[model samples]
Target: MKDHPLEQVRGNPSRPLQTIRQLAIDPEMCMYALTMSTAESKNIKEAMADSAWIEAMQEELHQFDRLQ
Candidate 1:
């Protein structure tokens, strides 16, 4: 699997919940993003409307899609 960009913010205290939110909010997107299972995508987008990393997050997704 490809490394997740979220790893940049991983050490942050919110990493755990952020991970949960990502998987919970968008399982399919998460699967595609991290090249990982929905159970573990290292994290993806959230249900909320305002994510500062949303853009970077989307870019991280499918980046390896065609390659894979």
Candidate 2:
């Protein structure tokens, strides 16, 4: 019979939950979706001062360049 994939890695069912949790949170295999903030900046100065907003802007510009 063919062995289950998880069983092949873990060898036993003693810590299935832990194994699953480790796989779910593994950095090398997992990438989180980028999230945008709902908060609005009053002006350019305010938006530019916030690092998160700056990063979001850079990512948007990168997408434009990548598609073109």
> Candidate 1's residue-wise lDDT over 25-63, tens digit each?
887755654653222333454423324456556777768
Return the lDDT, model 1, position 40.
31
Clashing pairs in 1: none
TM-score, structure 1 vs. true: 0.23
| Tens digit of per-residue lDDT, candidate 2, span 7-58 | 2232334544433356557654323211122456789998887767799999
Residue 30: error of model 2 in Å? 26
- Once fitted onto the true fold, the runs of candidate 1 whose alpha carbons sit more than 4 angstroms away are 1-52
**What TM-score, over all chains together, does every model reach?**
0.23, 0.45
Instruction: List ranges where model 2 is wrong by over 4 Å.
Output: 1-37
lDDT of 2 at 15: 43
The TM-score that candidate 2 achieves is 0.45
